[model samples]
Target: MKQILKTILLPLFLITALSLNNCATIFSGTSQDVEINAKPQGTTIIILGGTIGKIIRYGAKIQSFIDIFSEYLDEEDKKVLERYSFESLITAVILEVRGVVPVERSMSQEVAKVLAKIPRSYKVKVLNTFGMEEFALAPVKTELKTSGGYAVIGYMSGKKIVVKEINTRLNWTILWNVLNGFILLPIDVLTGAYKKLTPLELDMELNEPGEKLSDYQAQGPNQKILILVN
Candidate 1:
């Protein structure tokens, strides 16, 4: 009787614990918690500069890129090039769009917005600019169990392909949306990446920097863990 009860009770206890924790984030804590200061509003965009030649070397057409990039900008923003004032040069833009996305990292559709869209590449023109530079969005996300009953997070990312040729530069951007299932603040911060960005958006601190991104390192259906692919 004692042996039978032990086995049954053990299973019950495990089940109970799992049920209680089900609503909470199973995989949390990816970014390093640096002393967070007040970051400037809409300044310091992170650009993931990829060589146009390389992205072409991989799969991904050029036309699809323009459409994706176009969704991000408005008619007014397009005129930014002409405005080129001290503050109106469109300054520098961040590449919030990324390459391929893995499953489970999608976000809520309501809050996401496309500010600017860049069509796909027409030629290797943009690809050759990087001189074989390695580039892609640095995956970052933070899930906060707020004091209130709400989850608060911030994230930013984008797609950037630059074709470099000594002086002449060409670039084509694309669209990439990761973590669409129930994510709230991906426009500000990503939940999958465990680092918190500082007041200045340029740098981030991942406390456990050594941890592997997502849970997988390979490709195809065999891949179980999500990844920030280039």
Candidate 2:
């Protein structure tokens, strides 16, 4: 009788605990949808640059692979691989210097490094630039990681707008982990379920040519500038 009860009760307890753990990961997820809209309604939104660290790391991995296999490759193949690696390194450095890609370090550290060299309010061009990856028209919805370190740029009527970065904030849903003895806090953090992207919805007004970038108000959690084309 005692053995039977132990078996049944232990399984029940394990099931209960497992079900309670990772509340945020189970409920809130690690990404959020962001909606963007512009006053003129048809502006193009461009997402530029990704985690620089990842790009650099990938390039390094490729270079290492090429070096290991070079004994079997022809001179032409070697030259092609070397050129690709060089271009990748240059691209990573360019994006990093331009503040379009975030370093692999902590956000605070990266921001501190950037602020030391550049003004806090400075903005960088996004459209017609390197590392431009994705694009959509205004009034569009897209999914972004809650970890939040990306850039967005807008283009319309031959004008361009630049948003330096997207930001993230603590997600209240992670607090639910307290009920589970914080057993899931690590999971939430690892999956980025502990935070949510801020300014999930952005609505900006498009100004005519000759308008100063400072004249526009930022609707998101970063420096924004409007670049007018003649």
Top candidate when judged by TM-score against the true structure = 2
- State the local distance difference test value for candidate 1: 0.24
If candidate 2 were superposed on the true structure by all CA atoms, what would the RMSD be?
16.5
Alpha-carbon deviation at 31 in model 1, angstroms: 31
What TM-score would every model get versus the actual structure?
0.18, 0.34
- Model 1: lowest-lDDT 10 consecutive positions: 163-172
Q: Write the per-residue lDDT of candidate 2 for residues 68-164, one digit (tens) a residue.
A: 3445455655554443332222323234444554422212333223223432232132223434445667777777554434455554442324344
lDDT, candidate 2, equals 0.40
**Which lDDT value does model 1 have at 225?**
12
Assess each prediction's global lDDT (C-alpha) against the native. 0.24, 0.40
- lDDT (C-alpha) at residue 44 in model 2: 61
lDDT of 1 by residue, 115-225 (tens): 223332411233334322222234323322211111011122221111111111111111112111123222224544323223112132222221112211112111011
Name the TM-score of candidate 2.
0.34
Number of clashing pairs per prediction, in order: 57, 0
CA RMSD of each candidate after superposition: 19.9, 16.5
